[model samples]
Target chain A: MINEERTKMMTRLALYETKEGKKELKITRYSPGDYVMLQMLWSFVCGTLAFVIICVLAALYNIETLMTELFSMDILLFARNILVIYIIFIACYLMFCYSYYSYRYGKYKKRVNAYILRLKELYKHYVQNGNNQNM
Target chain B: MATLLMMKEKMKEIYAEYYKVIVPTVKAVVAFLMLLAINDKIGYMARLDSFLVVLVLTAVCAFTPTGITVLVGLAVILGHLSALSFEIALVALAVFMVMGLLYLRFCNKDLILLVLVPLSFYFGVPYVMPLVAGILCGPVAALTLGCGIVIHYFIDYISVNALTIQGMAAEGTVDKIRVGVDGLIRNEAMFLTLISFVAATLVVHILRRQSMDHAWSIAIFSGAMCNVILNFMGLLVFDNGPSVFGLLIGTIIAIPLAMLVGLLFMGLDYSRTEKVQFEDEDYYYYVKAVPKMNIQAPSKTVKRINTQRYHTNQK
Candidate 1:
């Protein structure tokens, strides 16, 4: 008395819901632009923090030398060089995040669309079987 | 060969049927081993070094994602280092944060390599990681392998210099941090290992991606050879590099282990390859299909008749 096709379809849906579907479904909640932008923003913040940590470590490593050269060192030039490096680093990080998240969003959207179609098919199966009449 | 293949088929069947339980159990075992190894290397923190603490953490790691294991391992490393020297712990934390926030965010799965490469070294089979990484992962794994090598060297440095580092507790915090950072960066042997590992991984990944018969085998062999040659060269160039005997023995052990891992992941039947030409609307397509070497375990069903019924029928 079981509908084999329905059973198979339901199983597939359940498996998807457990696996990658968990992440992909959440992606579907956001517009593609928003999702990519959010990712870029997050990467930018993390990248900046990482840069600052590296800078602090470098400073700590050369503290003795820096202390000796503190008065003699060209503060403006040092600031400019660090700024330039920071700009280049964040630029590369943001660009990568942008491209990666954009592609990922597109792929997830395509998958979620397929999943929706399968859900519709399952609903149709239920309707055709005269079950879940309210649906 | 036949028996091996049959055993592999049986293993595949068992794995397929019980993978849900198997994966977590393997995670738990690996976590436990890793925690024990860490404690053995540097058991500065008595509380974290306890067997009960490790078992509880291992149990949690079994149910959590693999990345959680890497984080737990990192936390344990920091705990031990902090107990030994607070400044060194800060230095280690900074390095980890840079790696995590900058690189690992995009490919966090590679975090496991941070745990694995060190464990492999502890087990005296260091070459397995790069060889397996090359076969199983993309080219980007070279970077991850390099990072893992750096981490291994850092941990090794910490354990070896724990007493000296503790002696520097009266020194300025910046000086201690500088010493810790210098110890990591100035290691010529670490640099050599990093170069060798990265080179081997790249070679394996590149060769494996080629469209050729016995590609995995060729890749594994070539990768192993590449690792040995690079390490040999490193030994000659660097005054203090990895032990030559360890290099040879590790490669000897790694070749077969990596090959076995490759076989499990990709068992292709190159002899049964099929090359066909077809035309699409836009262009002609020449495709080569390679079959996988998959053998399902034989299922035997024994049917028994009722003894009394059989006897009556015979009568």
Candidate 2:
């Protein structure tokens, strides 16, 4: 699945190499959005995990006085409480992930655009110089 | 925002310029503080506790590596204990031996925290230390923290039970062992802090291994919470009249401190794990490449203002 995705990404990206003393370029474009998505996914996972640990630890503390009756505690009620906390935490984390991703993606896109522009300038120069083989 | 960022970059540039001098100076200061603390808290040898001696040794340490400072501090502490009481010194030795077997082999720089951990504890914000260790170090830090706990507890135990222990020393050997064991096991506050920190370090260390963005932030937040909560529970369970407000405020302070530590150690970097297949003359090789995190500190170019040109009025 990942290999397929990589191939798909490769198809969309501009790949350039000098092979046998000839500059080869296939028609493609550079996109920073793909890697930005990967970064976003990573951020979301970490954000969720952080909130989860915090909530769990807090709940563990709040219930310590009742540890003697831990096993006898209401099972479904406990699950419901945990589930509610998890849902709330996850919702907040998602909001954080969205803002974080937007900020980071903007910077990533700017960097990638600059890189693409540099490559484009070189390509234009090569084309303007009569394919650079006329020499 | 942009101006703030530029100012931050300027400050970072200035710090980078003197990092060589700054880092060593900080290490030496830490060493000196540790030595001074040991002298004040655990010193039994009168001569070593002198201000002149501390000043000279600390000045010497300013040019030396931090590891030597940790050794010097621990040596003075243990040496003092030995002079005061043979049994406590032997116990301290046993703790160090355990630390050697468990932590020293894997960690060259871990011992420096021996003083730092207790310093944090003294400051009432020790939860930050485990988060710092987890984000910057590895599991071996747990042993260092453990040794620190033993050191703090050893001092407290000696101070509180000094007169009683003197009486016990004239009694049978069984009574001495009993007293030692009781102090180790029954001291709820110290053990609680130990369990909390060790657990926090382990948790943060494990979470840090995940290939996720914001891992350090997550680890710090989570580990700080874990430390705070565990200590709270310990207080409620063991100590009479647990102060919930104090615990909450400490946790609040610790979380931000841990985050600052995280910021100092970790920055956001995008890393990709890629697999490539290539053939050599003899065989085909499949390689998994995970690039290291790239750190780009804010760099600024310096421009000369030419103060000599301003003095051209004289010319």
Candidate 3:
């Protein structure tokens, strides 16, 4: 009867093991620097959208006849300019992304690695306790 | 009155946190220098008769915590916006006195080195820019200088010419340079505003992710509302129909862009699964902590169990 009860308790604890592992993994995956990158990207997108919308409106209103004229003069040039501008933006964004990821990875490795180490120690303690009792 | 008192207490907490990160002396110095430059620029541009009012407002901001200072500063700024003529010299003197008081009261050797040494450029550049290029060039120079700093991300340089404006220069000397996306989109003020919005949104997202309450949502909403109000104020000041329409269009475009970028950058999956999980976490924590006695009873538990089983299977 005691053995049966012990088996039930062990099963219950086992059920939570997967969940606890999942939680720790999730925590490790996200960091403050990730949030910062998200903020930067969101701002860039918003600012770009704002610029594009304003440009479209200005085009519609014929606010800058000169720009329209220039566009008409060389469609290829306009497209090229747009492409170059977007490439520059992408490069800047990539630089920010690299920095953000490195920063977050450093934090994760420092703090969360220590946490995982502590968790492993606890797991070892549990295993040792269980083995001793069994013996 | 009670609410106001509560708010003041809350603000004190916020100030304490802010002070931990950014020194009060640095904030005061930055406020003083920025305000002084702004005042000088405005005075040079249109013979702003209320220069003293601006100086006084700047002084108030430097000495006090941010909240009341922002309010007083806004009032004076609004007055200046209305083209009211006020005593410039007296306001300047008052502001100087306030700066002096802040220095005497809060200044320490370490504090001075931390605050003043770095901001020497922030203070000195604005003052020197106008002297070298004349008064009308100040704001343009300031804006350009700020943009250049942001662009380099580490280095500070002065590159913007103030005499580029037509009214500031001799006839036929005003070069009508082609305004490209680079020029239009690179305005420091607008960039800073967008950055601030992003920061607020990030804070909100992180708070929500941590299964915190909707307080951050309210904060972000309030910030966006401020931007909307400022946009309206911009419309009032500029009074250009197309520009106003463009701003509205810009806002409309921002929504989807924000979502797209959030998904791309933060991996915020806005699907039903994530939403349900988040809601479940929030509800579970709240109910576990805040009791409703036997009124809700076992039905709540049963419902939660059912939902949990469903989620478990789905996962």
Worst 10-residue lDDT window for candidate 2 chain B reads: B265-274
Q: Model 1 over residues A35-102: C-alpha lDDT tens digits?
A: 98888889989999999999999988898898999999899999999999999999988987787788
Candidate 1, superposed: residue stretches over 4 Å from native:
A28-32, A106-110, A113-135, B266-294, B298-315
Residue pairs in candidate 2 whose N, alpha carbon or C atoms collide under 3 angstroms: none
Score candidate 2 by DockQ: 0.02
What docking grade applies to model 3? incorrect
Task: Compute fnat per model.
Answer: 0.69, 0.00, 0.00
Candidate 3 residue lDDT tens string, B180-217? 22233334444543333333334334333444564333
The candidates, ranked best first by TM-score, are 1, 2, 3
Candidate 2 global TM-score? 0.55
Q: Pick the DockQ winner.
A: 1
Q: How much DockQ does model 3 earn?
A: 0.01
Cα lDDT tens digits for candidate 2, B147-204: 7886777676766776676676453444544455456567777788788889989889
List runs of model 2 lying over 4 Å from the truth. Answer: A1-135, B1-12, B167-178, B208-213, B236-243, B267-315
- Per-residue error for B283 in candidate 3, Å, reads 29
Please give the DockQ score of every candidate, comma-separated. Answer: 0.29, 0.02, 0.01
